[model samples]
Target: MSTLLLRLAAPMQSWGISSKFNRRTTNMEPTRSGVIGMLAAAMGMSREDSLDVFNPLRFGVRIDQPGTMNRDFQVVYQNPDDILPTWLTYRYYLEDAVFLAGLEGPSGFLAELEAALMHPVYPLALGRRSCPPAEPLVLGIRDVDLLTALRQEEWQASSWYQRKAKWQNITSLEIVRDASPDESGYAVRDVPESFSQKRRLYRFRNVIREQVFLDQLVSSENTENEQGTPKEHDPMELLEDDDVSIKSQNQ
Candidate 1:
């Protein structure tokens, strides 16, 4: 079987894997589902289209470059009329986010996939909720496999991804490795340090972390389908943010 390598990176991208809250959210890294969705969209697949083509394929993600993920949170006031005595807080947090993904399949299918991704019959999203892909590159691989070749490449190789033994039975995997921002690959660099520092001036890192934690708690507590009733929490929570409570302890 052959494989296709697609390079996805953008200045401001968002991949809301399981975001549930008033504030905007972003995935820590690009998601297999999101990438498939992007391809489906380019193929003019409707939201209801079946994803069987991509559902069973072997997949993996590599952290080529980490981009800053900044999301704004809105704090609602208790009283609409009250201004001076209003009790509300709103802010945003910025964190580094970057990832690379590899997909393997039949050679013909791989070629079609690469062309579809490059020309993108339609549109493409780097890996963000709000940002669209500006420049995406596709590398054709016939003799070498994606993960195998990537591991050998010196540009952004990582020991974690180099071990073939660890890849046994792993249809898919994601590696968050250290990468220099200067490396040539897919990367995002829109939210400058000045903006992040300016926002930090208004809200302490501890406070912002707390707010993120509170927002997660509130989100978990307020799960519903527009009627304000709780629904069954899915296992995909693994993809959700880590415990915000720990942020308090650090402070």
Candidate 2:
């Protein structure tokens, strides 16, 4: 087995689980379904395609930088003349966050995915089409289990955020991962059963959550590398962008 590491840092990201019409909300961190959707897109899998290929993969994530939350407003008008605030809703997302995602699977399939990510068949997004990810998305393959791989990976938080954490003397980071058959964990409805837009589906998944001490993680210079490093000039990269733009959509 092998683990594929992903540096899911984006200026803006939204991973919604129970989001529906009117108001869409984001989860605190990356969701498995959201991540899998991106992967499926990378492989050019259409909405009607089977998502069975992704079912066997075990997942885990380490929150290096838990970012601030931001909201978006969307308005709708039945017609040009009918515009008295007919519809208004709020959408929430995470700003300037960094996550180290690990997917454990067979080496061959993992390798295939690694290459596909490098040259994705379809454009990738961080939860939503408006939120694209930054460079160095694929952190390469790790020859370890899901939990160990995430634990051994280097810190992915921005430099300034790291400094702030150090000053505050923060020692641990939140770690969440898919639970094994014998492992106990809380249940979340994130496991992807289907990606068909016509009738989107998801199943319950148990995930183990724990705190990993800062010392237990590897430190790095945050350089851009295959092993998941940030760009040299990354501050929040928030001021700049991965070419991210926001436009109000008519719901």
Candidate 3:
């Protein structure tokens, strides 16, 4: 089997499994249904199209950079006639997160997907329309099984994160993978049943959470700040500043 790799990095991403009307939630990692939907969109498939072709492919995700989770409060007008009544909603997202996603399947099918991702017929989003992915989404194809590719591939965290790690003198990374029925795994209701917006559906899949260490680290010396200068000595300071800004806006 051949595995197709994708770099899922964005400023904000949301992978909702059982999100309801007032409270939209997100998983710590990418979901299988979300990834398959992205692929279908890249292939120019309609929401009503059959997803059987992609269902057989084994899927997995590696948490290279588990960014911070943030929540946004929104007010939706319940009645346009009277703006006094509003619906309060809370949406959750992963900020500055990076994930390594893999799909193992027939070589020809995966090759087709790789081509489509490189030159997609439709714009691709991480999990929601507002969450547009960064460039270089297609990481290329690997000649390995799903789990093997997920475990062997190098860390795919963002450059800024790599620099932060180096400044902190940190090493190693962790990853998670989809598991078979026979293996020790947890069941998640993320498998796709139908992509139809009017009648959304989903099933369950087994996932194995594993923590692997990566001694090999990518050089972050070339990483530069916004002004093209070397990054600050303390990355947490910058992170704190961001937090303050976000909190002020929310207030």
Candidate 4:
């Protein structure tokens, strides 16, 4: 059992889980669906073949560092009509996406999987259209136990990381990377350049549901919460118990 860590930082990234038309895009949290889509794209899997690899993923996520929770707009289209003014709108969501998983079986298959992710043939959307990744996303793969420990520690310390965690029956584990300098340099806080051709600029709107889901995904990787009954205290906690300490003064 190994885990994969991925770096998804990009200059122009958007992960829209639930967005509607007229470019009224709402950035949604990076969902299992969205992440899997990214994997499929990297692997060049056709729509028909994507689910075979995506549907049964045992999943967990830890957001080690959260990016600026900001939103920006992109002008999709515009028209001038005194009778009816309209603009195409799109929403962008920026949430640090992380994932961990155990493989289905066979260590030999890792190379194939990594190759697929490293050079995906399809267009990878982190979670939204407006938030397309800026460059090559980063990924790290390792064993489940080690990954779990690291993930748990990350979760314990941050409110942002404690969100966006999800549970799935993982068949395998693969992390995506942003290796392109231009693409990776983009951040969520960036505002797209305005187009002179457009008659209007549509402002992207933020939705709370996206935030909640993003948080849910990161917060879901809880090994302690899943099965283990809470031990009375951590070993360090026990040492701090002033009443339980026996001073060793054997000088």
Q: Report clashes for each candidate as comma-separated counts.
A: 6, 0, 0, 55
Global local distance difference test of model 2: 0.88
Candidate 1 lDDT score relative to the true structure: 0.47
The per-model lDDT (C-alpha) reads: 0.47, 0.88, 0.82, 0.40
Which regions in candidate 4 have their CA more than 4 angstroms from the true location? Answer: 23-29, 48-50, 74-85, 88-90, 95-110, 123-125, 128-136, 145-251
Pick by lDDT: 2 or 4, better one: 2
lDDT of 1 at 14: 68
Best by TM-score: 2
- Residues 42-152 of candidate 3 have per-residue lDDT tens digits of 999998988899888999888888999999989988776775688899999999888889999999999999999988888899888999888558878999898777777
Q: Write the per-residue lDDT of candidate 1 for residues 11-69, one digit (tens) a residue.
A: 55666533444544555666555676677767766555455576445555565444565
> Residue 31 of model 1: what lDDT?
53
Candidate 4 local lDDT, 1-251, one digit each (tens): 45444444443345443345644343322444455656656777655442544323333343333344555555543456444455545445454433232222233444466677677687666654445553224344555543343333322222333333223322222222221223332223211122123421222211111011233233434643663433122336546755553455432
Off by over 4 Å in 1: 73-98, 154-251
Which one wins by TM-score: 2 or 4?
Answer: 2
Q: Superposing all C-alpha atoms, what RMSD in Å does each candidate have to the true structure?
A: 21.6, 6.9, 8.1, 16.9
After TM-score superposition, what is the CA distance of residue 135 in candidate 3 from its true location, in Å?
Answer: 1.4
